[model samples]
Target: MKRKLLFGERMLLGDGTEAFNAVIPFRLRGIFKEEDIQHALGQIQAKHPWLRAIITHDENNIPWFEVPGNHLPIPIRTVMRKGENDWQEESAKEWQTLFNYEEKPLIRFIWIKGEELSDMLFVFHHCLCDGGSAMAFLYEFLQILDHPSAEIGVESPILGIQDVVPAEILNNRRQKLKAKFIGRLAATAIKCIPVSKKAIERKNDYLIHWKFDKETSSELISYCKSQEVTVNTFLSAAVLHAFKKVRGNAAFNKVSCPVDIRRFAPQIKDDHIFAFGLMIVVSANYKINFAENLYAMQEAVERKTAKLNPYITMMVMESAHDALKNFTKLLKHGKSSNDCMFSNLGRIQIPHQYKEFTLDTIFSPSVIGPLGNTTTLVTSTFRGEMDFSFMGSEGYLPYSEALAIRDEVIETVKLQLDPIAVL
Candidate 1:
């Protein structure tokens, strides 16, 4: 079985030179068997067809998820845990590890084994899965690992664009004409735009992670509720504020946050391994007080979110498939518009306690690609504690300044919960 790559997926698989990987790293304490880990992966691959599929290009060089009669198991690479930051070092390396898309599944696993505690990293090609779907895979792996007999129902994986966009819409004559016209216009416009003459040299990417205790996490949630704003908006406000303070006036006041398409498209369930994303860019109004800024950001988030039409966005992109190369170039070579990409995987629901082993910590997922800007802040609350993984490159953001921005973000959050402390 073969299906054409989506527009977003095509952009990710561009030239396959740079690593476009996403990783979910977590710590577990107890005895683990290598065979058991392998077995769990087998079960997951059996249920989700994409986990067993490889990318193959046609005569036109278009990528497709080609399923062979007999698929090979996803490969696993294991390393011995040396220190507290072993996973961090491995994560950095994983960002440089490109997927062999033509041969193996677009994902791999890295195990940092220790006597008492072990860290497991699930690394996937960004084109293969998003954060939510990755979390689903993690949850299922834990379930089957803890109990070999556990059943994870098979996923009727999305085959192609038809699965995501309803058949009725695709069949509508008017919609078809509109999509074709837009696609042609976008492609022509893309051809007319000038490509960057200067090549931006690639830089070594880094990941920094930290977490807030349960008390602090709870305080943040309560504070956001008291202020009538969502945690996402509050974090966006803090991130913009942090960049402005640390980078001085040169920082862009805008921050882009991705909205899970699952929220709007019922066709793509939580279990489906899909990678199309819709984003809303929120800008901070520094002229207002911090409290007022939060509210203003909340309003912006709500208004933009309401205006988002995932169906239309998908249709437009599908139409602009020919312009995808230009789109990828535009993203990687164009000037950086947003200060940073802030993603909040609000309140992870995976179970922490298993029958045999206990999950100690789930570091928020971090992904860095060879794409243009490297500044990103990803957050998640797991086991009652809020965790963060900040990834950036010195070329884009100096390590010293990134550290200051991280500290400023924490301080900014605290100031909201405790206003008097700011003085």
Candidate 2:
């Protein structure tokens, strides 16, 4: 099926910035041979249409997808080498490792076969897909690997935003008014804040990861339940506290949290479209105790988020696409005081048994946005454990400090429930 890309995805392609690129690595075990991996690639090519697509430009200079033919290789490239330092050396390459490809949406595969288990890294431009789509592709690829005789599933067609919104609906006066209001609010919010000094200095440079075992993960879930708050609320509150501690600012405030639009709108579920949805920013200004502050933060986030869901933002954006895009570029280049971005995928459900292999820990590197010197935290829960990974521009913030802040967040949450307990 042929479908247009989402507005956000289209914008990413238009800007042509490396910040929007996505890399998803899957650590696999119990693999037999190289041909087994090769066969999996063949099955993936047959199942996904994007794999065989090439980027073509229209008269307007906008890029769009075009299918070359059935013979097009699934955009998969293999790099096989023998030596201990090979994997270590290649992994250290630049985050946005460019591949020599004629197509706009380039998909490349890097395979490193070690002594016992093999590692597969899938890199693709964000213009084509998001983390969720990448994970779906990985899951399917694993399925094909487990059962080579299994029939490859039919490809899912891409559905564009224009197709989802009819022309008549786009012309509605009420929708137009709503879009105008949202755009004005977004613009005002951007103008009211001062650009973060750290962002201005361009000192962000460290990236670190912290994981919680099953026991600690369970404790966190229980703490949230007892506190009558969602996991995100608890985590966000903890992050605020940690920032206050490290920054030594009692007046700490402003956080950008990503809200997924897939469930907010049925039309957004189409696998082909890309959407950033609404950024829920929680303001910190009132004076209160640590626990009360957390509660206030939770309430602020929930209230702001309820005003307009992801669908509303998408509609607003669709109506004022050009204006919003221009405004966003200006904000990025100017001194804007947007503190950080926190994204929670909540929990991921992988099948207990994929063919015959057992699913293990899934780690996702944070996708940096166009704005420099921003802190992004992405969390995913799997197998009763929650994994939080932090990523930011390496020159503006120290990774070691950010990691310590993450641990402090986790520890503070644990202490709230069990003060005597060790996390």
Candidate 3:
């Protein structure tokens, strides 16, 4: 199976040089056999063609995902577990390590072997899949690892843009004209936008990890429910408030949030391997108090979310292929306007207890890319506890400042939890 890379895929793939990878680190409590791991991976690879495919460029130098007659199996590198922090160190190394896309698949696994407890990290090129896709992969892997004969269904992959946008919408002449006009206009504007000839110096990339105890997490959830706002909205407000409090005038007051395309496009299934997703920019109104800002931000989020049209957005982006170079240049050299991107994966549904092994914990996934700001905050609740992974570059956001911001976010949430009922 083969298909030309979509615009969004190409942008995330880059020139196939630097690493734009995502990692999902998790701990499991059991004795895992090598054969069991190999069997599970083979099943998964067989189920998802893209997981076993490699990237190859054609005449015009456009990348295509091609499944070869004899593609290599997904490689697993096992390292002795030195301590609890070994997975973190390995994850950092994986971030800087470039995938050999020409020969191997775009995904790999790192096994931190230990006596009783083991930590595993699933690393993928950002071009191959999104967080939603990765989590689905994880859930399946566990299911199969326990029972090698597990029946995970095959994926009817997305072949092109047509798969996502309906035929009726694609055939609409008015929509076609609008998409073309907007695309060309965007391309022209990007060319005219002033940007630094040199890229922003990303120095000393770092990750700061934290977690909220079950009690605190519960209280926060209760508070958000009481306010009639989502936990995501409340956390976004807290993050923005933290930056404004710590950085003062330097804060951007904006946070970029990725809207899962599956939510809008039913054609894009949870099992489908897709990289493209819709995005929304969120910001707080400083004129209002923190609680007021949460309500206001929630309203803004809902309004912007309601306005999203994945079909039109994809059409516009696909029309702007010629602008890829200029658009990438702007992202590489343009001034940073947002404080950071905040992603809340919400509650993970994967069971922690399995027949053979006990799933200990699922950490909040971390991702780093060369595009735009490297500062990002990701959170997800697993086992009734909320975990956070704050990743940033010292050049983009100093380690000291990032540390302070983490503390501030926690404090801000704790303050809001004061009024919530314990029961």
Candidate 4:
């Protein structure tokens, strides 16, 4: 089966020259055979059609995800693990490596071979999957890796826009007209907006990672509960506070958070490999202190989330196909308006231990692309500990400045939880 790329997928695919990659790194403490690893991946490939599909261009130059008859299995690249930081280094390198979209599947596996502790990086093109999908695959991979006979059901893939947007919305004539009109209007306005002829330079990209111990993580959760705010909101506030503290007036007041589309649309399954996502932009109210800002941000987040219309948003984007190039160009050349794209996957439900092996850690996934504002921070809790992956480029955000921001982010969160715990 095959289908044309969606608007978001088209933008991410670009010309397929540069990599827009997402790396999900985790460590396993046990003996693993290459045959078992490949078999597990093979089962995952069989369950999801996208896992084995390749990108092909049509006469109109539109990209399509097509399953080639006798398509090659997902490729694996294995290397010896030198230290704990090996996965981080390899993740950075993978971000710069382009996918052979026409010849192979969009996903690849990297096994960091070690005598007892093996760190694996499940790397894939951002156009092919999202954080939720990544986590789902990891859970399934771990299950089948331990029990090869595990019965994870197959996925009925979303082949077209129809599968994403509800049929009622697409069938209504009034909705169709509204979507077309708004899409065209937005496209025209985008074309008229002035942008820099040259894109912003983002040189020497890097990822800085850290984790909060289970005790500290639990304490922070309890603290958020007492404040009547979510751990996500509090963390957002702390992260923004750090940017302001480290970058001073140079930092943007805004942070963009991606909301999972599956929450809004039930047609999109948790296991389906899809990339579309809704977003909410947030900023602290400077007139209020950090404590007051948490409540304000929480309210704002809820109000915005409640108002989101995923069906309408999908309809509009689907109608805006002609403006794909201009929209992508605007993003690539647009002025930086936000400090960074931050996402909190919340707590991961995947089990950390199997009968054969122990799951050590699931590092927060990192994704980078050629689009505007390559800087991003992602957080997720696994095994009762919260982990973070902060990614940025030297030209956009210097490594020294990123280091300062990292330290400040941790300090700001600690100060909010407990001053005595600050270290």
Candidate 5:
């Protein structure tokens, strides 16, 4: 049976942000079979329902969703063919240009026929699935390609607005009163402060791409263990170091980190849900030693992570509806508190083998938008290495600055290991 799309799903579908992109490139040993590729694409579309859905708008500028039957899958385009050395360089540019998103299916497949091997690149928007979902979709695609009769599983459907929280409840008088009071408080706070001129002028237009070698990744993990801190804590500190150097502010130390509130309450863990989860604002005052400051930052993060309550985040989001209305004014006035965002998905586990295809490295590009450009540093450990994806707006922050921030992070880590040798 065809299912209806949820509000969150529709929001992503209608929004043209590149946040929902999943770029998967596969290297094949041999190719030249059109039928096999078509069959694989069919299976993929059948398994993932988002590919079949379309976005529509009403008179109010709000987005609505619809699905088509027996929808044709977007065909794979042949992009470029380059020799060994030029493959990566040529492929990156070609793939980015070809895979740009559209309001429709927004899925693209590219086949680059090389001398000894063939490369297949699959790009899909994030509205369809996240990292975990993308991995599952890729597995299904490969399985269908190798084995035609394979049974592909569909994702658990998103809950309609009425099913999870009734629309009437949102309009309840008591809830309205609470929202009003919270909104007033948020507005008053905004009026009391001035926005940072530097933050407003510094547009984030940069893209950061970095991968840690196995040895360096191991060392980082070991260091975290020895310090008795979570990998996120250590990573967050490293990010702060990068930001400090770029901003050149000794007192600039504030980070907002998203904490998944699922496990906080056992009852809600199994409920497949999507919304902004727990968010904690952390700050570190500039002090003497770098290591000591990091330790303090780690403690602050750990404490907040431990004490976060899901209900609190829900209440804050609900009550802050009024605050969202004046977000632009608050940001312009420099009342905005968070300098950056650190999101850690921790580790992603996929099966070692999926029928005929073996698992490869997974990359996740960080995403931030709608609000003032805030730097978001996303990290996910897969297979044995860490993949860091940094994403922000080109308007508020430049992409070149973001890349420089990443370089500073790696250099700082290296310095931590050999402080005496440098002198």
Candidate 6:
């Protein structure tokens, strides 16, 4: 069986010159045998068909995921653990390691073997899955490892655009013409515009991670509830403020937040391993107080979300496949407009307890691509504590500035919880 790649997936694959890797590091306190991991991976592969699929290009150079008569298993590499932060260094290295798309699956594993504790990094081609889908796979892997008899159901993923966009919408001639016209116009415009001969150099990428204690995390949650806004909104506000303070007047007030398309498109199940992205850009008013700025950002988020039409976006992208190269060029050569991309997976509901091993901590996943800007912050809370993974290139954001921004972000959140500080 073969299926065409989605717009976002195609963009991620790029020209096959660079790797677009997404890695999630899981910290486990107890022993996890290699055999058990292999068994769990086998089970996961059997359940998800895409796990066994390889990428092949058509005569037109478009990428397609094809499952031939025989498929290869996902590669598993074991490394000796030198220290606690060894996984971080390895993950960074994996960002540049390109996958042999024709011969193997787009996902792989790196296990850091330690005496007492271990870290497992789940690395996937960004075209294969998003953070939500990756988290689902992680949960299932742990479940199967803990209990061999556990029943992790199979997934029925959308195979093509027809599966997502309704027949009525696709069948409408006017809608089809409109999409085609828009696509052609975009392609022509992109060709007419002059692009930079030398793309921005993205070097010295680094990830800084930290977590808030349970009490502090709980207090922050309570404060968000009292203020009638989500923890995500508050965090977005803090991120904007921190960037402005650390990067000085050069920082962009705008921040891009990715919204899970699954929310708007009910047809796409939670377990589906799709990679298309729907994002809303939010900006803060630095002229106002922090609390007021947060509320304003929250309102803006609500307005943008309410207006989002995933179906139209999907159709438009499907018609614009020819513009993929132009989009990639713009991404690589464009100047950084937004300060950073912020994504909060919110509270992770995955079970931390296993029959044999217990999960110690779930670090926020960090991903960096060859795309121009490397500034990104990913947050996820597990077992009532919030964890953050901040990644950026030294060329784009100085290491010293990133450290200051990280500290300011934490303090900004804490300041909201402190009544004296608010006063």
Q: Which candidate gets the maximum TM-score versus the true structure?
A: 3
lDDT per residue (tens digit) for residues 1-423 in model 4 = 999988888888898877899999999999999999999999999899999999999999989999888957889999998998999999998999999989999999999999999999999998898989988988999999999999999999998889978788889999999999999999999999899999988889999999999988988998898889988899889888988988999989899999999998999989999999999999997788999999999999999999998888888998999999899889999998999999999999999889999999999999999999988999999999999999999978898998999999888877787853653
Give candidate 2's total backbone clashes: 12
Worst 10 residues of 3 by lDDT: 414-423
Q: Of the candidates shown, which would achieve the greatest lDDT relative to the real structure? A: 3
Clashes of 1: 0
lDDT of 3 at 229: 96
| CA lDDT, every model vs. true structure | 0.88, 0.61, 0.92, 0.92, 0.58, 0.87
Per-residue CA lDDT of candidate 1, range 1-423, in tens? 779898889888788887889989999998998999999999999999999889898899899988778867879999999988998998888888888888889989999999989999999999998999999999999999999989999999898888988888877888878888887888787677776765465566788888989988998898888889999999998999999999887898988899999989999999999999999999988889888998888998999999987776788788887788777777777777788899999988999999999999889999988678878999999999999999998778888898999999999888777853333
Q: After superposing candidate 2, which stretches have Cα over 4 Å from the reference?
A: 1-6, 17-19, 74-94, 99-105, 149-152, 166-168, 171-173, 176-206, 250-252, 270-273, 284-286, 309-312, 352-356, 419-423
Candidate 2 per-residue lDDT, tens place, 183-300, comes to: 7776666566555333244443334566778888888787777666778877777776677676565324666777665555555453432435556776654477766766677787
Query: What tens digits encode model 6's per-residue C-alpha lDDT throughout 313-395?
Result: 88888888878878788888877889999999999988887778889888899998887788999999999999999998987
Q: Rank the candidates by TM-score, best first.
A: 3, 4, 1, 6, 2, 5
Clashing pairs in 6: none
True-structure Cα RMSD, model 1 = 1.7
Residue 167 error for model 3, in Å? 0.6
* Residue pairs of candidate 3 with colliding backbone atoms: none
lDDT of 1: 0.88
Q: TM-scores of all models?
A: 0.97, 0.82, 0.98, 0.98, 0.71, 0.96
Clashes counted in candidate 3 amount to: 0
When sorted by lDDT, best at the front, the candidate numbers are 3, 4, 1, 6, 2, 5
- Candidate 6: regions farther than 4 A off: 192-194, 420-423
Could you give the C-alpha RMSD of every candidate to the true structure, in order shown?
1.7, 4.2, 1.1, 1.5, 5.6, 1.7
lDDT of 5 by residue, 189-291 (tens): 8666656545455343444667787777777777677777778777777777778778675325777777765557443322232332457776655565667
lDDT of 6: 0.87
Query: Following a full C-alpha superposition, what root-mean-square deviation does model 6 have from the true structure?
Result: 1.7
Runs off by more than 4 Å, candidate 1: 419-423
